[model samples]
Target: MIDNPKIKTIENLLLNKRVRLVQPKNGYRVAIDSVLLAAAVPARTGDKVVDLGCGACAVCACIAKRVNGVELIGVERDPIMADMARQNMSANGFTGRIETNDLTNLPCTWETGQIDHVVANPPYMPANRAYLSPNTKRLTSCVEICASLADWIIVAQRCLRNRGTITLINRADRLNEILSTLNRGFGSIVVFPLFPKAGRDASRVLVQAVRSSRAPMRITSGLLLHEANGHYTSKAEAILRGAPINL
Candidate 1:
């Protein structure tokens, strides 16, 4: 439990209440992107999965709820957020540990080529290009601060085993950057776009690549998140309800 009186928080239900998350009230809160990213990970029973920058462990909770018997680990930079993640995972009856360390400089405890899968919903905006927020937590969560996108990918590559996969969700505009960084250490890339509605451009993309694979990149048809009336599509709603999505 967070004992800081100055820090305000709110409780939210994720994956149809399978995951109960307590997050800071004012800072960056967990959103659907976390759920979507969790759904995209192809983790199986007995596999060890690591989530980089796992704020509140929403992705970990969601993945645990969806896939049984998978070992879950989270890396979070903020101590407060890392505590919240541990609390959330415990409340959900999930077993996992949250390491409060910057993703750019992971602790030596994390052995190389041990993790079966790596999933991340990294900060979307680059620090140099985007205006930062006044709040430190929100600024660090949304905009790249100590770690850039490439830095996150490098960490993922370092921790993941050969043939292990890394899944990420980011802005569609940054697809080129994501691909360029991923190409250096990963292959079998699949770019899955998330469209806001029919006939509209994708606002976000989910990219999955396998470490040391030689398969060619493929772009998927993608999934539409909402209908014309702004309601969630059935697929998106199912995903929010802890359904799995193949990339």
Candidate 2:
């Protein structure tokens, strides 16, 4: 019933049933970032995972599909999204395991280095640009007025076990910045480039790293998401459909 396009929200299906996010309309809603971020790293059974800045719970839902039985905690700075995330998890039958929280409000048990994996697709913009939505919540989703990349890395590093993996997706041009952050906080880095189309410059990239891995960095075969005809590449389709991407 809402007609505001600038509202930040989405209606999606994760584990089958329909679900809604805190987003209203016309705002920065869920996009391919959710899929790309979830698929960037391999998940194992029983992993304790956290999704930083989990808007509408899309990434967390995607992760739940990839790694069953993992303990998932969805962190959202916005309270409305927190409620929506809880609904999304409930729709997916994970109301108990996939719950809402703010890192600042986390229980002492969860605040420590107890998580086995951390994933994020954080805001790409700086803060408060002319293009930012008038809706305060929508604006926060796309800009970093509240949390920064460094803050995310710090929280992830602290929450993860010694070698827990942290996976993220961001603009391709930000690769170096991401690499720098990961290198400073963790090791065993892996990078994947995601192109908008064949022969085009990569527009997005996925990066993963282990908390204290000693292995050398590996840049895997980059991914192409579309063909010149604007059709989804088979590789991209597979990933979007919850298929695994080889590291």
Candidate 3:
């Protein structure tokens, strides 16, 4: 882990406090979307996974802790966030590699059709439509300053082998764009919506697809996070606490 005395941070835990991460205090903090995205990945032993835009390595650490013998590589453009991602990996005792590079312009070392799985929780808000935060980190985390949804899909497909999986979480309103992009190199898509309440409209959705597959798309019943009293349901609690997400 590289030392950065000038960067102010706060420690947070994930996977029911099993993984520790240090993130910029006033910047984009780790969100549940990342954890949920990690859980959506069906990694087996010895699988090679790459996470795009891996802020603070939260998703990497979460998957590593839950899936044994999985090798991970994270791509992040921001130097400070990339440093924090590397530190978080070391702090969590993870063996993944963190590369400080934009996903659209990855290094030559990242070869095509070699990775087993690729996961990402990219920025959901489009720059033209959403309010961009003054804070650079927050703005970048929420808006796509460097890459578009199609760019992320293209890179993930370039790195993943045939039949390899790509999992991601994004705003429900953008599911159409997500599906369209995934169709370019992926198939057999399964979408799982995350509802704030039983009858509420879904605000977020987790989508998983297989590279170059031919199966039909399917949608699950989806996950309702809260009860009427604004408390987490048992299913939500289990998933948030590290239990594997069932598609």
Question: Candidate 1: worst 10 consecutive residues by lDDT?
Answer: 1-10
Candidate 3 lDDT tens digits, 1-247: 2446868888887888898878888878988888888888999999999999998898999999999889999998988888888888887778988888888788655768899999999899989988979998899999988889888888899899999999989999999999988878788999999999988999999999999999999999899989999998999888889998977
Of the two candidates 1 and 3, the one with more favorable lDDT, higher being better, is: 1
lDDT of 1 by residue, 96-160 (tens): 98999988676655759999999999899998888889999989988988888998898899898
Give the worst 10-residue stretch by lDDT in candidate 3.
1-10
Residue runs of model 3 more than 4 Å from their true location after superposition? 1-3, 107-109
lDDT of 1 at 6: 52
Question: Global lDDT of each model?
Answer: 0.91, 0.73, 0.89
Model 2: CA > 4 A from native = 1-10, 14-23, 96-110, 128-130
What would the TM-score be for candidate 3 when compared with the true structure? 0.96
RMSD of each: 1.4, 3.5, 1.6
Q: What is residue 233's positional error in candidate 3, in angstroms?
A: 0.6
Error of 3 at 193 (Å): 0.6
Per-candidate TM-scores read 0.96, 0.86, 0.96
